[model samples]
Target: MTNQGTRQRFSPYITFSREEWRHLRDSTPLPLTEAELEQLRGINERVSMDEVADIYLPLSRLLNLYVAATQNLYQATNTFLGHLEAKVPYIIGIAGSVAVGKSTTARIIQALLARWPNHPKVDLVTTDGFLYPNRVLEERGLMKRKGFPESYDVRRLIQFVADVKSGKPEVLAPVYSHLTYDIVPGEFIRIRQPDIMILEGLNVLQTNPDGGRKRAPQVFVSDFFDFSIYVDAKEEHIKRWYVERFQTLRETAFRDEKSYFRRYADLTAEEAERTALSIWEEINAVNLRENIAPTRNRAHLILEKAEDHTVRQVLLRKL
Candidate 1:
């Protein structure tokens, strides 16, 4: 295989057997209680309280440390320059394949980190909001590539992150509606300079420098990130997760009258299964291979999941 192919296939110091992963999971502390687990029952059933306590709890604790260290570093830099400047928000980027449990990771991290004493204000944003409106995509003949990099308003996304990192007064991100399968007009989530921002998406770590005789500018979404995480799992496992989530939605979210996917609400189980598989193959899998998976090494930490959606092993980038 070529060098590119080899990197695509594997990463050194980032692989683990299932059993070893289980030992790690077993050794991790569980910070969430049974009552809290019950609270998260419906929204994210795939990841249990045990999963949060064992995997995400520890991860949140580590992030707290990183945030504190960053604050001190910024303060020292300011003191050396003899200028008083407020600390910038610590930005985190989370990347993963479709249905690889990244949204859950983002949400879980948001909740956990908010509970941390040091970082009281934690904001979570998904790149879904950064996607162009469906009308724009349809006008450009890119409706089918909705989750691909080209489907996004990349310039707007970059600007939003840059503004946030720059400590702008307030930055508002467009809100996306899964029900309408489009960006909501005039609806946004405002971030008021939080202590930390968790930005989650498929290709948050992917970067492509401007190609020119003069290096125009090298800015990718990850350029603004203080740290990043890539959620990793076998392709087959992710495919199964996609299908399973589809099935779940068919019974729940798809049934909502306001849901854009309401048309699929009446699909029989077998029909739904087939439709799910087709969508995964055509849209998600292609994006995963072409855009998302290649950026794994760029993350500061990697969470590898198993077929059942449990975090099997974690790979921490060596300091």
Candidate 2:
């Protein structure tokens, strides 16, 4: 815990309570209806309309201003260069532990930012697509370590982000499937030029990921980000949410024929719960403590969540 003492510094972050942060919304209207929000919520993640109006609306408004300012800086640089060039998209990176509702956060932020008139085309991309396929992981004996830093194709992920940030007219990213638990071969998500791009993943802020067969890349993913957010919650809260989600998936996705976890479909309530806890304790919790949680302060902003999954405090890095 001494490292945590070293890592947790008060000087960089200006902390705001939920009430104080929500007031910063400054009349920004809630963008999504109840149905849309419900659709966006992750398994076992409770996000209400009030969460949006209070937490996300203010966050979206801040992002809009940042994007506009970035766009202006781009124009100014172009003017100084004496030639007009295509402007690149503003990249926002979201990092968090598993079952902390990162995908929901990314989707909600994408929807809200796209609704802003200035930036109508906002794209959301996850680093899941950059993960190595099950075949490769099996070859490397990494099936149990899937979410760890070494399990990713870090070089390819870096190249993809570099291309996007460089304003490549069209870029392709590999597709990943949660149900099958593998990269979908020959399937890709094509990203056209967008006003903003949100990149969400567990380890986006990782500066140096080691212990793989391949050497670590020289570049960090956060280097290309205009701004970044880390979704923070207690480890116990995340583990509980993960187990609950696993149980929910046991009843739903696991029942599908194509699910990688189809064997779990017939598990009794006790068996399912026990299995979920074992996986979390053995795998996810280790990764969170060793790889993910340490990168929290690297974010431009940190959303500290309560046990109930509500934003209790917002920590914006001091400029």
Candidate 3:
């Protein structure tokens, strides 16, 4: 579409500005405390409770409300249809760029929503578990494009989610290790009946490759989400975050003897900077541009953040 046509269809996309964007950062009646936030702090320092309460607490509340509304709607439907059966799991998706604090957001929301009396037994599963084993990626010469849509076993992922949403008795998802950056062998996480399931990862919203009858089933992962959130920030800010996270890992996680990235643990400051930027430029940036960013419109809500990693504005899809 031409710029004029695009403008006519998506006026909201072009209207947000730093000066005009304002949402007060305040706590809820029952907010996540500093101790609670500390439990969620990942290997990186970017995620904290203030970030959660200011940004993700509101998001979690919104998701809870959405799930409740969905339940009410389903009950009304059941009454009209004259059938009685328990509803399926409510799925929530979260997408964001690498080093944009997506994992932290997922963990925080999972913890908070579990505390909600209405939606207990909330389980968090990541699409990283759907990634093809390293051997497969190497065989396909796709190791460099690990985060690309093609690198995942999309069929298995879609099937697992479809089964869960269809009220399947049990669904087993593969386990992935951050240290090795690959699927662990002989290990799978079993998700039983749960009130809510939070699916988190990069490229979770990408479309399937096969376009056939059995292959091209329903919508992708984003379709299963009762509510979806995409963390947003300037590209420069994300780049800085990537560099900072890499530095932290060098001093911490990478130092683990069993880590696959252990070789990088001894990298000098200069060498580490070069290595981080190289990976970002070659792999992460390409995947973000070609795969992830395009799915921004598929989200139910967008939390736009500033350079200092604070949410500055929120773009919500009008229902």
CA-only RMSD, every prediction = 4.5, 3.0, 3.9
Residue pairs of candidate 2 with colliding backbone atoms:
none
Global lDDT of each model?
Answer: 0.82, 0.92, 0.80
TM-score pick, better of 1 and 2: 2
| Residue-wise C-alpha lDDT for candidate 2, range 1-319, written one tens digit per residue | 5864555454588878999999999999887999998888888889999999999999999999999999889889998999978769999999999999888999999989999998999989999998889999999899999989999888899999999999999999999999999999999999898999999999999976664446667788899999999999999998889888989999999999999999999999899999999999999999999999999989999999999999999999988
User: Among these predicted structures, which one has the highest lDDT?
Assistant: 2
Query: In candidate 1, which residue ranges exceed 4 Å CA deviation?
Result: 1-31, 38-44, 208-217
- Model 1: per-residue lDDT, tens digit, 16-58? 4445444544344565677765654434347776677667776
lDDT for model 3, please: 0.80
Looking at model 3, residue 85 earns an lDDT score of 65
Between the candidate structures 1 and 2, which one is better when assessed by lDDT? 2
Candidate 3 — which pairs collide?
none
Model 1 residue 224 lDDT score = 96
Positional deviation of residue 116's Cα in model 1 after best superposition, in angstroms: 1.8
Per-residue C-alpha lDDT of model 3 across residues 1-319, encoded as one tens digit per residue: 9997787477544333333332332344445678878888665546655566556666667777787888788889889999976558999889999988788878888988887777888989999998899999999898997878888888798889888898787889999999888999999999897999989988777675331224555667667777887887888888888988899899999999989899999999889999999999999988788778888888877778788777777777776
Model 1: pairs clashing at backbone N, Cα or C within 3 Å: 179-260
* TM-score (all chains, Cα) for each model: 0.87, 0.95, 0.88
> Distance (Å) between predicted and true CA of 238, model 1?
1.0
